[model samples]
Target: MSVSNSPNSIPCLLLAAGRGERMRPLTDELPKPLLTIKNKSLLAWHLEALSAADVENVVINHAWLGNKIEEALGNGSQFDLNITYSPEISALETAGGIRKALPLLNPSDYFLVINGDVFSPNLPLQGLLDQVSALRSMPNQPLAHLLMVPNPNQHPEGDFYLKDSKVTNEPLDGAEKLTFSGIGLYHQELFKDLELNVPSKLAPLLRVAMAKNRVSGEKYAGPWHDVGTPQRLQELNAAHE
Candidate 1:
């Protein structure tokens, strides 16, 4: 199933408002999303790929050093994309950030969300888009379809288990578990009930949906890195070079 090229047909929200406390002095002056990997800012890589996939409208929410993010990306013309900024005075956890950006998202039934800090060079955006497009015909549409990856060394315990494409917080005997890759296709209904402007974590919401079998996921065994620390950034840069 080919995705439509229409502008904003499938809008994406880049979660970039974290404080980056672990990234320390480096983030003291620069927001983590603007941190460079192989000479390109992390968020820049996302914008480039998203544009290539014909996803034109992107909402980037920023808090710390957000002015720099705006100064760096402007209206996203260079990337052939329309960028909208959702500014936050302080970091609003994942769910809160998405809720606040709802108005700017064009009120799509479903939208894509990607964590600004993670790096996945081969993220299959088109495939995920196609899946979501197909789901529109289902009677019991899933609230979200996440991209899961093999647990990285930093997170050995993993987050959720996947069986028959369904995501669950509970462990299934003999089932291989994977970590959430921080990339997903989400239906607006999943977030419609949340209290706006309040700090709320996304995990709890996902877990609740999972219990009802409303969340689906797929494991991606590709180049992926959760660039949470300075050392990891250095390693990713060196590996790419």
Candidate 2:
């Protein structure tokens, strides 16, 4: 699954609406995505990588301290991309946020979505881009292609099982369950049933798709970190330093 060498104008969504409850004092005033990892906010890391991957348009949804995100990366010009914000009155969880941001993410039938709090500095944006074509060509009419990773200690139970390259909610084949990397390329039909602006979780919607075998995924063994805690942030910063 390889994409053309010539860069294409791609659209992407960065989910940055979490309140970061576990990150406490650090996020008391600032949003979790704005937390600095190495002189760069976590969102900036994704923006830069997306820009390099030839992704020209980005939509970011926010609720807690969203203004700070706009102030930090206005228009995404500095990173060579056009930035758009889908502000929510309240944090609308994953599916809801994606629903709210849908208008801005339109025109492109398929788009890449990344979790704002994760610290996957080496996320394979180009690699994910490569799957767009396959998703379009598949006769199963697949609705989403996820990036899967080995479960971290905090979530050892894992989220879904990948067998025959298709994501499944159950271990039907006794395959090991893997954690969703919070990164995926999605098709609009997956959210066709979602009510716009209403809060919803992505897992339930994903489960529905999995039951129909409409979801596909690939394992990513790259360096990935769930920055859900202060200690993890400190460790990442220290490691990078």
Candidate 3:
């Protein structure tokens, strides 16, 4: 399961359309994705990493301060990648956003998706890419492959149970349960039936797929941050400083 170092073969979608109500004043004028850490915008970190991986094209969906995102990362030529934007008048929830971007993302069966607000320096992009490449030849491919992480203090209850690399909504007696890291590799068929321009969440879709054993996941134990509040953002920045 060897994939080319060039990530151009796989397009990436950065989900940046969330209205960061928790981030408040900082997000009043800037989108959460534009918030800075170590003096670099959060989305910038993703762009740099994708560029390093040689991911040629990236599609970003933005709503709050969407224009600023465009202004800040135009064409992505500076980062060695082509950038396309899907503007939303209102923040379309995760599933909706991905559904809206399908036309731009067509021709490819699977794509990489990452939440713009998370800071995971050690995200296993190569491993996920290799997995997706292998799944491409399977007769019944999984709808998604999630990167799960230990539940943070804010979400200790966890989301899904992972057993033998498969994701399930039902908790198994001995399987480890973990939180969705907001990072994943998703196949287009996952959102094929989603209605256009309607707000929808990703969890429901994932749960349905989980029932069919169409989802796979891996636990990631690394430097991962769910930059939800201003204090956490400041702390991350200070640590880097």
Tens-place lDDT digits, model 3, residues 139-222: 779999999999999899999999878899998777899999999989999998999999999999999999999999999999
The Cα local distance difference test for each model comes to 0.89, 0.89, 0.89
Candidate 2, superposed: residue stretches over 4 Å from native: 1-9
Candidate 2 worst ten-residue window by lDDT: 1-10
TM-score of each: 0.95, 0.95, 0.95
- Over 4 Å off in model 3, which ranges? 1-8
The lDDT of model 1 is 0.89
Instruction: Encode model 1's per-residue lDDT on 66-87: one tens digit a residue.
Output: 9999999999999988999999
Error of 1 at 31 (Å): 0.3
Can you list the residue pairs that collide in candidate 2?
A: none
Q: Which residue pairs in candidate 3 have backbone atoms (N, alpha carbon, C) closer than 3 angstroms, thus clashing?
A: none
- What's each prediction's clash count? 0, 0, 0
